[model samples]
Target: MILSCIKRVSCGRIRPVLTRFLRASTAKHHDLESYLQFLQTQANVATESTYYKGLLYEYTVQHALKKLIGISPLTRCGGTGDNGIDLMGSWNIQKAKKKLDSLTILVQCKASKTKTGARLFREMEGVHSYHVSKSRQEGRTLLIVAAPSAITKQGFAQFQTTDVPILYCQINRVQPIYDTKQDTFRIDNFEHYSVVQGLLANHAAQALLEKCDLSTAKINVLMKGNSVEHKKASPPVVQKITLT
Candidate 1:
């Protein structure tokens, strides 16, 4: 069947393979409810573990950022004494001709089930500001609260007043999608919960990007690189599973 699918592809027979594959895959999963239940189990495990939960959330955010923005972030574990910043990285922004610019980014990750309020945002802003000043580097800082919860309206308003741009990734807002034509399953609303998108669209975030001297060409390059990485890093479908 796989070989036949390949042959069909070479002969421009895309519709049949897509339809058949999607049907088979969807049948195996049963329905969205089951998939969501599995996700909920995973979430429960992450939340129940005290030590591993924060690490898991930080690593997940790091991986997501790499997949979504094409920039690798450094994770600072708690035991190592992370002076308030959880992740830090730099983006190589390419300009006209052979010129290259670098934007230093600092990120703080929050893993909680409750809504993030103004208090947390204020603390994050203060910590990020102190780090930037102490390091003596003119860098753009952003706080990434990756919780499976909402942000208080007051908290969001408070964030806007801060110098550092605050972005959010609410896991609950992510929706799973099954694409029949491509025979693929993925989180369709990941971008909607992405801090990177917030940075690209929000006025304050845009100002920060501009302050870092990122040109339109550089921004385009960054986004294009991320798109390629996302395709390469997508999770593969399980062909079969056996229970003992």
Candidate 2:
């Protein structure tokens, strides 16, 4: 009986160590996967930045289009491939009764890093003129120039004078890079986390109106089951979207 008791005690002592070893192994694998995913995302963004640098002119134009009203390459433009504007995308805005209305935009990407001058503005105006001449009313036409570097204040002022809105994406202002060590992202000087979270919020509100997935943040808020319906239906989707 004494031997039996000793054996049971030994087994009990060994169980926790064995269980801890298994848990440590599982945790190590999970951490490694998370780290690898972070690295992959950073690498992809960096490669894109390098490629943009190589084609400095085109990058500026694309950047301008994206910054203005959050139009991305992924958005549907619903336009033709005429004139200088090559890409298109759209964003859904929220309205009363939580409805989503999409605004489509046409982009003209110009790869020109040269210093800004009257001639550059004229060239952009000419592109806009040509775009209008194509007789397409699918979406608003935007003349964009992606410069290799920055545009002078004088050049920006020149664009401001006209009813014709010319979008200029300066190279330095919109440099997107992902740093793995910092676990952070940036577009030029702008941080990614705040911007991403804002987008997620907007997306959530729009989607819920469209009967899509509720914003994760919103779900969390609702899950808490707080009865503070104080601010109408502002929906926490926007905040959740920003965190992404």
Candidate 3:
């Protein structure tokens, strides 16, 4: 049955459906790009001072993680912080007829024009190690470096060699596109999409989603049990057509 369906789609019988799907997908992509552009503009205007820029970077990382993972992270902004940890959060996993499990995540945000190198990664690892040792909380830790520009090849290579896991989120600068007909400036490139996609595809994010599946299943079962019932009505008599 699946093969037959695939053949039908391949034969272009469902070309209209495919076209509609593509259009809808493109519309969604455009909408997301517009939203990212708005956020970028806000960040650019808000981060005037160096201190404010760092704060904004941390806040952006926190916001993005919460929005993408549905988990609110605790942000440590000013003052002497816990080593170098910027944001920390946990995911609660519920199981049927089993004890609940929790997974903790630690994030470090960097808003720099220069690419992050091995030294930065080592520092983060040291900080995280100290934090875990003191707190005695054993869980997965992820280093998230949110930069306005791209990470250098050397920096990325350093990241790959680091024992600690890290996630790099590079926000690409949007290029301005002038519309001659409309006499307006349009923005191109939305790097936030790729950043969000990377976070969503991370192993930690997958674990969180897997845990949520249990909750979703339970909710679905409850919804099915409490489903609304419609009253049955009498059928009308069918009108027979006379043959000519």
Would you estimate the TM-scores of all the predictions? Answer: 0.54, 0.38, 0.48
lDDT of 3 by residue, 1-244 (tens): 0111111211123111111111112222223334334444452544366655565455555554454334443434222433565555564444454332544555666677665566776676676566543343423434455555544556555555655545554433233354668654443222223233222112333333354453323432332332223113221111111111
Tens-digit lDDT string for candidate 1 (1-244)? 1112112211132122211122123233322333433444453544366544565455555655665455543433233335456655665545544322555555666776677678877886666656554443434444454555555777666666766655554433233454668655454434322423222222455565576565334544555565664564433211111111
Clashes of each: 0, 18, 0
Best by lDDT: 1
- For candidate 3, the TM-score is 0.48
The lDDT of model 3 is 0.41
Highest TM-score among the candidates is held by which one?
A: 1
Model 1 CA deviation exceeding 4 Å by range: 1-47, 97-100, 171-204, 212-244
